[model samples]
Target: MGLVLGDAWLWAAVEWSPPAVAEFYIGGGFDTPTVVALLVAALVKAALLWLILRAPAPGPLDRRAKALRRLLYLAVAYALVLRYPIALLPDAVDAAFQLALWTAIDVLYLLVIRWRSRMLRAAAGAVFAVELAAMADVLLDELDLPELGSGYIVELALMLGGVAATLITLVGQRRDGRWSRGTQTAGWLSVGVYALVFPLDVFGRMSGGDMTVPVMMDALGYVGTVWIAATARELPAEGRPADLPPARRRVIRVAVTAVAVLPIIALIHPEATPHLTYTGWSMDCYDRPSFGDLKPAERDAAFLCRARSTEGGVPPMFPDSLSDQEILAYGRALCRAKDRDEQRALLTRAGSASARSADQWDLVYVCPEIVGAAHPELLWSTTEAEAANAAYIAEKNAKCRDPWPRTKGVVQATANYFLFVDGDPGYLVHDPEDEAADEAAEQAMGKVYDDSTRVGVTDSAVLIGHVADVADVCLTVKAFRTPPPQRTAGWDQVNEVPIVSRSGQLTVPEMGEGGEVGAGAPMPNLAIAGKGRYRLRVYVRVDDAEEEQHLVVVFPGASRKRLKLKPRPVAGRALSFNSPSSGGRRAVARGAGGRSQAELWS
Candidate 1:
């Protein structure tokens, strides 16, 4: 029975992941290979047990043999019962059922052995009781009553009980006339092997270390079981061994003791054993191809091919067979080419169409850098290259100006501004400055600028000029109370002044050209209370314009004065004004108002 149980554990450790015992009867997932393998193994074991039972008794059968026969019968019955029903149960229920089944088998064994010897019976009964209690404890643990700590306590008791039972069985076999010397030796050896290996196997499993120790122990245990079974069959009914020579007896005892101590020493100092080294690739290198074994020419060709396969325009290939000097010369010439087209032509002429072979993308990208390291003169300065490339791109964009509508009045306003209308869709005011051009281009392409045009006021007359066309223009001249200038150090620093109140849009005709549009008089209700400098702002929207005209009206006691407007590019947006501080002040006020208010101010 001990040998049979030991074999079961040994097979479990050797043949299964998470051990076969868990997968066989308890683990869910019936379609798994593990469950099928276990079922097949159980069937094979049952067939073997039947064959063993049918085999003729070697001489007249003893009490031990009869007990073994009964145990074998129970084992076969248990295997058949567990094979189908246990597999069908839920995982938790299956685990509990397996535990109960094993405990019942142990109890039955205890009952069978009781008639043999009183001391053995008591020990086996105690072991059985302890095992049953341990099963109950496990079931309770699964229920999560952790305060009980029944798992640990019951496990310890179960181990002690097993040890006691083993000792009592050994004593009974020795004293009773049912075992031979060979059988006794085999039985003790089996026990000794189990004692040495089982704990180490358990520890290895718990600690999650290498399975080598447990596997070695399991093999040793199987050998011991085989030895015990063979010796038991050959032994006589009156199972006492023939007397052995003193020297041979001492040698056998010494060998057994040495075998038992070795596993203990190994468990205590595992590092003393030689370990197998893993040579698998690291995480970073796993995806990359190893070119260490490839020829230099082949490696280079592979790199070139890889670069071509990646998304993006394929770069012209370089020859794999080029010498370092030749490679350096080629790289220098490629870098110094007048343009990208010239570089592409030079690379195309030097490369062979048939020689393309893909390698790592990174290697291909850095191929020039790799060869250039040998001759620093051949390596292009990255900073210089980047600056030149940027200048070239800017020049190209500057030359590729958008074709504006040819209108009689539309002329390049100064060198930086131009105004034109494309049919009646809208008027366009473009600033020749690169930043402004880019913004105008984006607005032109998108064609949705309802909130783009706006108006605002400064200390002078209302400045208005972001109109795309004057056709859709509307001027709202409002009188706003200007906040008191912030005082710093007892003197007003005039840091900021904000609009406090306003009237509705003044009745003024749509603006057309530069003329006396609003009687050229100070618009009524445009004056604020107190000695504050009041200004009237005219709001206008040219068709599809991203900017609004902000005309500032200045009143000098009932008379309106118009200031000369000079449109200048300020931070990519064109603001038509002559005052140097107007842009900065307007920006500060707009920023203070936050985004929505800033949009309104604009």
Candidate 2:
């Protein structure tokens, strides 16, 4: 007993560690303590039943008679309560069904043991067959064939055959007074083994594998149950002790049978993480809407834009700005700026030219770096005043029992467009009164655009802007890469910066420091051919520290004339970018200036 208990202890210790046990307890209905208690109870019950069956036969309690009684007891437990519970839980519900499956398989083993009469054996086999079929069905489903859901005829045949065989045997052995001691023990032991293996299946599910442990356990349980039944009902083997009570023998048989199941259960959890698991983004978000219940398009758009804005720039993978050669010229000038003042002046001149060009040609453009800052307004959101107003509107919905929590701070600024207002201060009108008062409020606080108009469609709470066709005009922006007010210096210590598109793919060619790196110097300008979309994906690395990447997409048809957004500082160690509208010929054409080719212009 000590050795047996030690084996159980040692194995369980390694198999069910604290973390694994806790996860099991939380994920399943039963905790470790309760499961242990149940396991102990099962052994005790089996032992007691075995003891009863093996007790000395009073008067007419012959071997055959005792077997009949055992068979009757096991049969009753099956038809009504035992068998059905296995099917009670829904398929998607993992834990409860798993428990039921193991319990049912164990029951089959027990039935096979207590019934020695050929008829009773057949009856038990029938029940086992039904369960076996079900197990097969489960396996086939795991294999993932489209037809598996419909039902497998082979499984059905096995189940029906077992049922028929059992019925015939029961009729022929109607009066058999013997139960198979071997089957009874085998069945009980099989269950104990199943108890150990059950958690492994659950763990597999957690690690994203199909739960097929039950089927495997059932297969082994079947053989053990049959063997136990055969041993229990064995005819006095020539020199065997005929005086031994049937019940006692049944207990001994079951105890030994349980040993057969131990190794299999112990081996269940060792399989490594499956080759594939449906976890990560697919399980969490892609399969269903995780955040707000937005549509696929809306979510995709929001996600792409938010990602770009977060990095403070649009993706540069697609060159929507001046071509590589032209950008190289600008880059050369930018890198040559010796002092902070010089850097700012050089960047400002380039930025102004880009901005004016964007404005004049209606071409979307972005200064790779303005004042040594790329996309300084990415973090900007609705102001507190506007947030308060949105809250007020939300309260109105709350009062009406149609609460729609105001998702304030939902506004995001795009590269070519700015978010002017999401929920601006005084955005919602709570009161309507005299004509004069209403007129004043409307005149003073009327929104310039609504949701639709904000995106350049209809009036809305959000607004975006883009350059118009032929909006080419040179405008300068200042840069302060170095510390405060200093004299302008030409590029000297700057290094070439490469931009990337939204896909993390590099777009522009390496640009060197052109002599153009001067404050108030005109940046190489380019024009958009038509109402095409574009994004400026720029990578800026100053003084060889870290590279800062920005991706911006400009939807000419979407933006308004101008957007009002607070300039916010970029707050990350490494800045990256992505924009959806930065692909294809929508980008700026190279070589617009007379002297320099597009590739060599920058």
- Counting clashing residue pairs in each candidate, in order, gives 20, 107
Best by lDDT: 1
lDDT, candidate 1, 1-602, per-residue tens: 31255434534533433344533533333333433444455454444344333332356655755555445444444443444565666655755775765565565445433246676677667766765665566666666655223355555676566445445555655655455554466556666776776567645754553434544453454434333343334434543346668888888788678777866775563543322111121122223332333455555433333323323334334433443334445555654566656756765666734233322122432354544444332233335434443443334234322211132111111011111111122222222222333333344424423223222222221223343322122222333343221112211011121221222222221112221121112223333353334333222222235323222222213223422122222334443312122222222111111121112112
Count of backbone collisions within predicted model 2: 107
Model 2, poorest ten-residue lDDT window? 355-364
lDDT scores of the candidates, listed in order? 0.39, 0.31
Q: What would you estimate as the lDDT of candidate 2?
A: 0.31
TM-score of 2: 0.21
How many angstroms is residue 10 displaced in model 2 relative to the true structure, after the best TM-score fit? Answer: 22
- Per-residue error (Å), model 2, residue 317: 29
